[model samples]
Target: MIWSSASAGPTNTLLPAGGCTLLPRATMYAPRMLAAVAQESQQRCRFCTRARAPRSQSAGWREVRRSISSNASPAWHHTRSISTSHLPRAPLAPAEIAPSKRVIFSGIQPTGVPQLGNYLGALQNWVKLQDSQRAQDEMYLSIVGLHALTVPQKAAQLRQEKWDMLAAILAIGIHPDKTVVFFQEDMPQHLELAWILACCTSMGKLNRMTTWKGKLAALQSASESGEATITSSEASSLNLGLFSYPVLQAADILLYKATHVPVGEDQVQHLELARDLAETFNRHHATGQRYFAPPAHLITPTKRVLSLRDATQKMSKSSTDINSRILLTDEPEAIRKKLKGAVTDSERRISFDPEARRGVSNLLRICAALDESRDAHGWAELVNERGGGSGMLKSVTGDVVLAKLEGVQKEIKRIKGDKAYLEKVARDGAARARERAERTMREVREMVGF
Candidate 1:
């Protein structure tokens, strides 16, 4: 199964029951107590947890109860940033394929070259799922064009951006043959499924969504200091897209009846909503076996990557400062510049203290995520491997980052030139996605007497 990262939605395939990690009930339910939080943050503390890291470092899943400034950085610039066609190459197929036993699905937006944060946060983990070769699993990599429509857009421009994003996905080694790669808008099933799920979804549930609040805050901060009052209408306008967008997302996962949804720590709340909806729908339909198997979620193994300029904030395209993030498609020169110019503490000594030194530590997290060795893969690894006495963490971390991204940079350049091929892939993917989605949608519609 293949997966291209897209927020919007994706294709369907029967994936084998691949190994999936789950949080202990205690972790999710009693997600407080500084000791518990500290222990969790010590291990895979995503960017959000770092800001509140405890004095004592801990490790593993008990270490995961954290939040983030959260991040994504593919919104590319017009300049000769990193182009997809010119860099080194990643494999087109995952290291392994699933045995026919279960199904799994995931997606990401093809904004541009994925940033280090995007890679570590989501895509890098996707590669691992591909290679697992579990039975009963079919993976789909979808370019969610429809989900991208939370805001207004120029038809011509968006169309091209989607095309560009698709190429980057293929170039990153998401096997076209193994995974269903397609555009979400091409399949009517997604919307149909979404509409059905929305009927069962509660307005109260939507209100609980953090996406709206986060976005409103972001907008407020971006506005002038004395910029009038925060009106519901202002927030309402921005809300149409990314905010009310969750029902569709729940539909996206359940449409495929996915057993597992790979997400960043920030997206867990949305996944929980999906799980809740699945249970509600099953009870309503009264099927012998559960219609949807309250899917499990797995966050990427690495600590979440944060902004290069500011650790308090997650890396994002929405940031007004262009320098805050390192776009995946950015040229080596640009990346080097960003890393070199990255904000660091005045003290020259490089250590993995995310709380006091966010800028440099962000760089370390990025490097550690893409590292070949286990010690560098997780956040607590920072403290575990050499927390007490520092080594060449900074310089070494820089080299690791450069090595990991080289392949992605090269692939993006090559794929951009083959737009025709990319289009075909998208079309074929849409056909496959639609076929699977219709089956799920048929049952959903019938349940509600559509």
Candidate 2:
């Protein structure tokens, strides 16, 4: 009764029994929210197209027949009903359902050595996921060097940055054996799939991306002020890559059939776009099957880490001021100096008001994120209880941050010393990634009639 694709070959096995399972009521409803929105599109939409039937035959059959009859178009009803008749009348209860293995994915751009914000915000989360992952779960963490090409870069500097990034990832506790950590540029299938997805994506969708808009606005400002490296005419053409890189990002996730993506708040939009493209591809190519599952966001606690110099802006490596951020490789003295000089309000009383007192709030957030035992508000209270002003707050926060980074800094230095081992790790990870990517591309090519 299983529907296997003859053209898909043995390696590209489609799920049996129409890929139906008794997922929890909560999990089942999550995809329905996406399906409801997708159905409005003019194109035929079959997102999360599995039928959810109950355990009782009379109730399940009635409900299954009703859903298949109502949700499907007139053209699909005959074929769908014929397929449903072969399925079991009684479905297993949610408690009886086996735990589904997860495919987790997240990537970071190889711009330079990771700063303290990167450590607390993303790298730490990556390590946490690795440590807590289920035995059957698969994890992919990539240094997205390809994504970095959207902006101008010297070849030598870019190469060095990639090396530094690889070291930083390992230093932060991303074990190669536990997680597939690879360079994005090493996998050509990423670009190959990106082109295919780009065709499925619409320009209107790309235009609405806030990150792309922000980059354009920044570029325009730089051009107006005559501070831009490229001429105004060149700037217009150069930015095309920036506008389209999100599609590549989508390819990165969908290529691996990733079910969960760890992303910051700002990157949620990109993840949504990936979901849309997954649905669109299924609608056009997979017939009635759900080929790609929409990835859910694993939003981290430390979503936004602000700059030390300017609380309004995110901590970024691109900033001209070195004091604005603390690098992972910074010595204890350097870390203490930066924390000491971090901008805060003149208020004698400490509070966690991000809007009114961004500087003080930023320091408190750092303390809370590092400690994990308390929140920003708790740290604020502790600072005030001890009658400690900004100086005491800075000193205590610096001590905690240094304590966290001390081990990571030493690990990074040790990892960076062994270039041969780093190369071997990259090669092995890329090989595994390629094996998986190739399996996907084969099915994709067959479905798309390539």
Candidate 3:
């Protein structure tokens, strides 16, 4: 029953039943024109008895014309006879349309061996998504070496860290067959697209990000600790890469046309910038078509493991106190000793009050993550029932953690030994990623008149 504009003059409108209704040019785009035609057709004709059903192909055009002519008013006689063969194809039925596959993209920096916070906060969720996603879903995981370059690094150490990160990703149960794991530095298109997006991004927007400010604060603290005061000139000489890091991040997501991005709570602001830049490109650069879809946030679980030395801050690799975080590759003895020395309150009883007893609650949270059968409160109750206090809680948490990491550590060691296999995996992943990126860039180049 819907009316669509035809290729003919403005006075003519095409109906789904292979006929043209003549109307005034002013009413061509009006809904009332459709309503009046529908009302008249229903009262006059028998062919439109079931208004919602598909038109039967068996009813020839001559028969339809005769039916309308016999029943329609004098005004209806002006309807033009058109061949059914000349009609536009009917819209597909709802059940016949195929659903779209999800395109997912996420990245992590290659700074060092992933710690407990990294595993629980991001990597574990990635493994869960890989196992649960549909067969046709596409996933891309990148070791963002470019992002790491925003800070100072040793050449040999950066190379080793990249390989270590790749090993950890495989060790954590993210299958190469299910996910495309590659290094971000391998793709030049990432940088090229980054430059393009950077031109569209505003400096004021980048200034609002908190990560760069944190980096500057860390830099100032480091300089002061070394007994060197940073003058205004030295501060002004900060690297541009550190300030505009989010622009590159936005390019990474937009280049892939990702529909979903997995990110931690702290990184949500960067993802929001990606969405905004996508919208800006579609509104101005796209030629009457939305080429990029704004990616949605797939927030990971709230497994924010805090530092053992300072409960107020997140666990970080940059912490000078090695005891503050547990690396994934730590030996069983090291794991036990670190947990034993973890900072907690003077109260003997175990509790899960994060605001008051952050250190104790962090231990309980880790235990809950390792053993999903119980939560932090449940673990606290069990430890209290054992009547051993903080010592017993640490012991219980250590045992579960050791058991969980045993397999991962062994796998990482095995993977690291075979350098050839890792190279092959990287090459295959880069090839696949390049093919998709090239296709997107081709269309983008043409759209921007390159």
Per-model TM values vs. the true structure: 0.70, 0.79, 0.76
Expressed as tens digits, the lDDT of each residue in 244-354 for candidate 2 is 988998999989988778777677778778867776777677763568755656644554679999999988887999999999888889988998889997777899999
* Best model per TM-score: 2
The worst-scoring run of ten residues by lDDT in candidate 3 lies at: 1-10
| Candidate 1 residue-wise lDDT, 130-211, digit = tens | 7664545678767677777676567887777778767766766777777788887787788877776777788888878887
**Candidate 1, backbone clash total:** 48
Q: lDDT by residue for model 3 over 1-450, one digit each (tens)?
A: 000000111112233354433333223212122222222232224334333322243232212121225565643322332222122322211112122677778899986679998898888988987887788888888888898887678999999999998999999998889999899999999998888788888899988888877867867897979977787655764789879888898888878877778777677678768866765665456632346755666644758899988889888888999999999999999999999899887787888999999999999999999889999999999999998488999899999899999999999999999999999889989998998888888887777779
Which sequence of candidate numbers ranks them by TM-score, best first?
2, 3, 1
